[model samples]
Target: MNARRCDDLRLTGSGGANRVMEAELKRLVMRSAFDVRVPNPKREGDETLLYPFDARVAWVAACYHRTSSRISWDLCSSAAVRLEPLFEDLVPVLSSDDRLPGGPELRFSVEVGAASDFEASPLQLRGVVKNAIVEALASRGVTADIDSEAPDVVFIVRRAGTPEARRTVVGIDLGGSSRHRRGARVATGLAPLRETLAAQLIMLSRWDARTEPLVDPMTGSATIPIEAAGLAVGAAIRHPSELPWRRLAAFEGLPGETPDLFPGTAAKIVALDADGECIKAMVGNLRAAGLTGAAFDQSIVIGQQDVRRLTPERIEALLPEVRDMRPGVFCINPPYGVRIGGERGEHELLDLYDDMGRALARFSGWRAACFVANPKFVYAFGHHPTMTKPASNANLRGHFLTFQF
Candidate 1:
């Protein structure tokens, strides 16, 4: 394929959660005082976003964005299926820019897109791409090794465009690991929500982490609560220095190795779970995320409580600081009943939803946001949602519903 230069960086976020990512990106840009432009997706339903290539902007995005899964330098795009032409343009850039690893030995891997239609299988396509990259690097006097199990760097090769006019895009992964693996979740419960998805729910709810309180009534694994706590404190999702971008030549001379986090405020966050085991997991996750001790206790309160019994009075009792405060937010991810054994389990889950609805009604002047895969939740709750946003939890299609209590 003949290589075409791309002057933008690419960020891929979770499907059905692009809106949240866009909003978060804009906020980050504003806080960082960067003049980068945030543009809409090229096409509807496309999860990839493009931004003008600025080393600082890319670094900030790689470090602070809670919604992006992968950040990459848009190396080249081409209509040719062959790897030679693509790397012809890519190799010169890597070699001159010092993008290749400088060590005595280098390890790398190639990831191909599932939807990429090629004459070869996915495995074969990966092999071809790897060979092309290695040959290109070797020609530039850089020795590299193929290490799929563990690699210092990874390259993403994907096919885009229609079948009639297919195109191939190549990028170097700026972060070696997926951003969603925030390095805090040491333990998880059944149907644990993804950390990025949890952040999206919080953003979508418009929960003011500073003035308003946030509660997760069914805090399985405490993903929602942990994310809320981080947001309240203006914590970077992950440290900037941990990313691989710093080691690359393309990002050389960029300042702010230590990202400037948003100014945080004292927040009253509560996490509750009926299952003792889940509560234990939550504590472990909290500790892993460095949210412990008396100071943390003042801001975040955790306990075991059934959702049905979760009244505003119960919350006030847990932390008296919010007794006279303004209306807060209720962010929950309740059971979806897919894993529950059978008809009896489904009925029990529905009943639980009914009880949850009744308990939520007691919290006057509050807002509740829930993501559930089951449509029965609305009927059981007996309330029309103020907003119904289409979202997905893993492979299951779900809706994020908001209720005014």
Candidate 2:
């Protein structure tokens, strides 16, 4: 695509919070050397931010982003609610576009969401939209078929606005499976933290990743530690071949190589949990993410230990290299008392948070970030946080609080 055509392209990514995800995207755009035009923040209840498209944005989001769940290109939008006229308008555009995937059989999937003003059900609307697209492509001399199981391209058809002023949008999904699934942690312990949320905690904590030492005391399945290690080594979360962008002509000549597993300037990372099974799960997950042999020995240490018993002396004994290192990050996703056996009573969970705060206070100069679902954690910990960012963990809403000890 030429520069003017690129300007016509718009993209968006979905994640936990709009503000946090938008901030991360800005950082990624700057690091990738792409000029992006940021759209005004989405209105309340909106879950994504739109930006003028850059091929680098799509490539980096597919392979490197730890925040976005999925990214999509906004193909077209119209005030017309009818499917026929909307797709008919694309016939000329489709004919002239050389970037369209050229294969013997074009496998595709369609998703539809209709507003309350629409009379048709979602399933019926989806069928109408699918037929409209297939007919449109055939008119342009391009053959296409529906393959929901494994599709070369996934299209989204959505309707919005009030009855008087309705708008429909059509977009193509560039992210195939969610970006949060890093293909690691085959065994997730009870109430395990999602990898993307863990990455957000690490980013919010501002850990340098090179000189600092990271410690996760209540590291169930070691999600936070493993994500830290992955980020330090510049690991690609998704293989280049699996990305949907491979089918797009605009992404030609982009770097498709995954970096070798080398802990050149990686920081010292420690994972400690009270449960023995959690430790075993962490080991298997580390191996799955290619952190083994020399990489494991040089940068990571895993052990079973209760959070209350974690102290400066205990950490030094577990990983002696951290003794002289600079203060780093201490992040955790502790129990929320809603799920997971034991600590069902409110008092028991509060006591655990109290003990956790005391243990974390022992590490002078270290920065701490915790994800808590309960509102009482602030009072129980008895320490004012330096900053608190609203976030969500699964179905429950929570906050990520940062502290300096």
Candidate 3:
């Protein structure tokens, strides 16, 4: 027999920072299918459903225009074209000529780099980038006739690092050396990340109802951690506030659902930053945004606290505080290699990952959700975990690979 041949897709190199993750996922899928207990069975003729190859998977690319973080979104967008030939086979389940079901389009979402014009964002950038994606699809012969809602599969690309093949993405999405009347910034502003992170908590709450006390150990700008805890719980960002409630109710260019406008039982969230300036500004932003529950404080625990050093006794002490007296996993966003922090900070981060892995092995039943730019860290995470499908983050080029234990 031909060894029951199965298909596999491989994306070699960093392709910015995220290419390695994409390749690993391809490996993960192939392994899953080949090692599966039951082979994927073809539909029997009379089973009643016809699969179409007409609708294509849209491979989307996004690079954020600017942010507090360092990612050259523009360079990522420019480099994404290289992925055309490489990513063509991302999904191999359907035939080349298979017709799409009701739709023949597959689209990808890419954020514009901050270096690009932000002024126009209030006007035309969205359309322009959409056009770029359509053309990118054309390069693959997947969508010469692309349109809105036409794609069956959407691929989003964000470049973050120097891939082995595409060395060092030189472009960035931050502002130019000089400021302009119409600044080049990603206009949806910080509101979206805030809403989405909060919504993530909502979804999680639905999944595991018993899990109450939400926590984000390292609350930078206090946005993510606060949102995860719920606007009602107790919110805190790095900056200070003068007019908290008004800022929360203020009109953001992009509107989002704020669950805790009067989040009654606000989380006792503590926003911590090593920089006093950041802490001050965060307090101001929180007040300006009218956030009610945020508290600013300096924290050595956020990124600096080593997981290896956390003893079972220490963890047990806080166990009651985490899930309202129940044991819960610690969710975190570890540093990827870049900026002053991230992986570029010598090998301090790599050692951190190793330590975390060993700690996780000790806490086998603790369900943890860790987002890493490099997915292989999961292997280093000490214990085997169920991995989720990955997504791309603009600030960092690599895909956001999630591991759940």
Candidate 4:
């Protein structure tokens, strides 16, 4: 048996919210049997390094925006000598032979990050790496197809070690598509939260799927509510191993198997939106996600109501079905006035927030964890949160502030 070595792996999150992503990574590691170590932040500029120690960590890979595993920092004089042996080494270790029947007619793309002194065009180097891998596979009697542009596999080659003493590092992407694309989000609102960020916010809110209830008063496109429902109902979402990589002949682990993270617990969730168009979009998205039928109907109640007019009575009126779910979270990703289009100026936005604060005051016991772009407006809501954390979505900057009633 080849012993699993702890290679340098990189798991990506949002640009400004590494801490939130780091927290999620830790949570994922906690559920595993492996003794994984999540290192503290060591970053240059905006790039943060989150190293999770494990060889077979496909389950947690989905929670990350991108991942690069099996980092090799070995100096090599030639591309063929470097890449061929790398592919050959990975074939057995990843258990490629045990992949799906007929095996994966593989597609691949190669990217090289080397200095100019060590010359090789991206295309020329891609061809070299491609031919080397193909030849290696042929030697093992494994037939595969390689596509450069639209590939099932991606191999990244970078200069590692140090500038003074650098080595060629090769890493394989576990899958092609980012896990954030849950295949459920077909429609979106003007300002939609990234699926992973929504998941992160849900985690940060500390809602228990088995016991606590969840309500998204401004549930644009139903991303948060649908994700919560998927958690509640134990929906089968795909992971990295189930991707095209699973069809590799030497891939060993069982494909299509995900962690039983859902504990067969269903939460009472209610999603509300002021715009009729937004509610319509939410309904269509929920249906596409297979969140239908009587139970789901009772669990998730979507309707139209302006958030500005939200009151304790109005909240109950919207979801009269939430009989036992008292004092649940009102998790929302509201208009940060950055991405979501609104004609309202700064003064108007402040007033809108002020009104929202007053409306939320009516739900005396219910707490809130909201993503606010402008902290200045956070005070518009009469009460201040007990804790605050920085957050970001792509280019937009924000903070997640949790208020306890």
Candidate 5:
């Protein structure tokens, strides 16, 4: 068993590789029996993935079910904002699928003033919160009539402070898509997600023989990539009961359905970025997850390369070893809003996507998948999608579109 100190938690930011490392720390320690809480940063890349060092604390996570940032000033995302960082503490609890990553401004907070599970609240304030979430999401193109059960993503929130401060905690219902419905609210550190993703990757390897690598080009302090890489390394799946990150009372909230959204057998999954630093960050995260000595050995390889101009010769150079392997899958989660460059990079990305589409078209046997929120990509790819699913990452309501040749 590992012992982590609560106050000793650390957070650092580096471009590229350093970000991946941040993700690694988030995966392991959070999933394990502990979490570390550090000073939270306003920006993601500036924050640290926390892990626990003590056994007395628990972490909680929360987010708005809505996708849009502007919510008529009624729905406050302050809860998710404070909650996202707490996951590193012991016994951190979170929404199964994170919400803030898709570009919706989010926040998290602790549940202060111990109260009974079924505490009463004014009906009016409840309605306001619900309307704000639903309205914001609608702005992002999600139909209010859309199915809410077991969505690919969820937002968890908790309120911490004196009762006079008027704070409340909650999470997106896995059962239905309603802003008014209440459920358990908790915080989670990046650690648990890292482990969960690692476990998923390991299990996926059995059949597909493809290691789906998570790529971060503009790796912020390195939460997403690091956590993703940890999941790639076969980390064991664990719940918050085993670890403690913060404290919160149980909630009498609704539940929703959760299931796998990614499609494919997992052979030849590749994650690439133009920034070598981001590539290194994820690699470090993978290593920290104990992947270097485990089944992921030789199964996952990350490299520093630009997504633009992916010429066949250039592609062959990086993946020369896989020449004999069957045609694989290529998936990219590029910086849609956060790292999105101006027209110069945007044009480059569009042309690169065109090249990607052309490559997939030529390979006919290969499938390329991307998380796209841009119009130009949809126009340039020039092929019908084999499957198009709605999903969220970084608070953005995006499509998980793939082309199967």
Candidate 6:
């Protein structure tokens, strides 16, 4: 049994990706004996701390940042910031935790956050702290190397209070690279959805492969189908062992492999797109994800068909492979004028959505989970979503609409 102190492990993600992140974490905690706490309303930093984390739970999430660091905030002169105390605070935690990388040469970077009124240059302050940290480690006979680009560790310094109560807070980044880059997405379109967001959308759809299959009509770059394929196969997509922190001697016994989430049979998924290029990309993505061979062909059907032109018969024709599977939900991110460089007129887009809605209406018992920036266009479907939730991507605000047929 691992006996190290259960420090709060922080996870970070894209700006609006935290809700699904929290929900995903909760599912993992429930599956295991590990203690996981998702803040009621996650804080502002796009980072959530999973307290008393079990290393085994890494399979469910691959956050933008993960860290066990000392948080010190202040409102003061940037030059007044000291580093010795911060590293001193981290040593105990890093040294005790066997999952982190140890170093004779430690690459690190510093991010400075200042109050609106502060005068000191963050660049200058970073230099000061960096020098102090190097000297501080040297004093203890611990050698260190600093690499600003792709640093093994990242330190964040933020201003907290007014000049009268001046202070700056610092935190070390634990997870080296964003866990969202799960390696499957090699090809992309003009506006490919982020993989993490795609996975989150799939989970939120609540489509079960056992009883119901998933359909992505707009499978741009095939992110949704690829992610679903990963989940269905119980493939350990996120390889935490590749993280720089894994080199730390302190993290001596951390598991290098992520266990499969699903075992036995794979899930049924249909990937469709109007662009033949996207269909090709989907196949390539699935291949990259090791979703090839006879089983993959039996489970996933990739084709090029315009969703607007889809009829129940045509849909069946296009997905004859999964025709008997009875698709449960249409989980998709439909095109918007602003994204993907809309080449068509506004009326054309509305008509397309209307046609899609009309075509889908025939399913009678299927469901829909559509993401769109403009809620007004939803009316074209002639049916309102049973529920709507807010979501964002690429800095564009949007809503996730769920409809029951």
Best by TM-score: 1
Task: At residue 10, give the lDDT of candidate 5.
Answer: 21
Better of 3 and 6 by lDDT: 6
lDDT: worst 10-residue window of model 5: 65-74
lDDT of 1 by residue, 250-321 (tens): 776666445436665788899999999988999999999888898787898999999898877788888886
* Superposed Cα deviation of residue 205, candidate 3 (Å): 8.8
The 0-to-1 C-alpha lDDT of every candidate, in the order given, reads 0.76, 0.71, 0.33, 0.60, 0.35, 0.60
Tens digit of per-residue lDDT, candidate 6, span 36-60: 5444432444433333333434423
lDDT of 3 at 217: 39
lDDT of 4 by residue, 87-133 (tens): 44444433332222243356666666543434555556556555655
Candidate 2 worst ten-residue window by lDDT: 1-10
Give the Å shift of residue 296 in candidate 5: 4.6
* Model 5: CA > 4 A from native: 1-207, 210-234, 237-241, 244-271, 293-297, 311-323, 337-346
Best by lDDT: 1
TM-score between candidate 1 and the true structure: 0.91
Ranking by TM-score: 1, 2, 6, 4, 5, 3
Off by over 4 Å in 3: 1-210, 231-306, 311-324, 340-346, 360-364, 401-405
RMSD of 6: 6.3
True-vs-predicted CA distance for residue 298, candidate 5, Å: 1.3
lDDT of 3 by residue, 1-405 (tens): 101112111111112323222222232223221232212222212111111111000000011111112211111223223333213222221222122112234543333332232234411443444454455444445453333343222222232223342211112111111111111111222222323322232233322323433334333354544344432332222111111111111112311221222234423333334345545544554544444342522111232234566544554444434433444445555555455354456466666677876665554444555555665566555555454434334344333333444
Candidate 1 residue 145 Cα shift, in angstroms, is 1.2
Candidate 2 lDDT by residue in tens digits, 41-121: 433233555566667776666666676665666665555545455545444444454556665568888877444444566
**Lowest summed lDDT over 10 consecutive residues: which window, candidate 4?**
66-75
**In model 6, which range of ten residues has the least summed lDDT?**
67-76
**Cα lDDT for residue 405, candidate 4:** 70
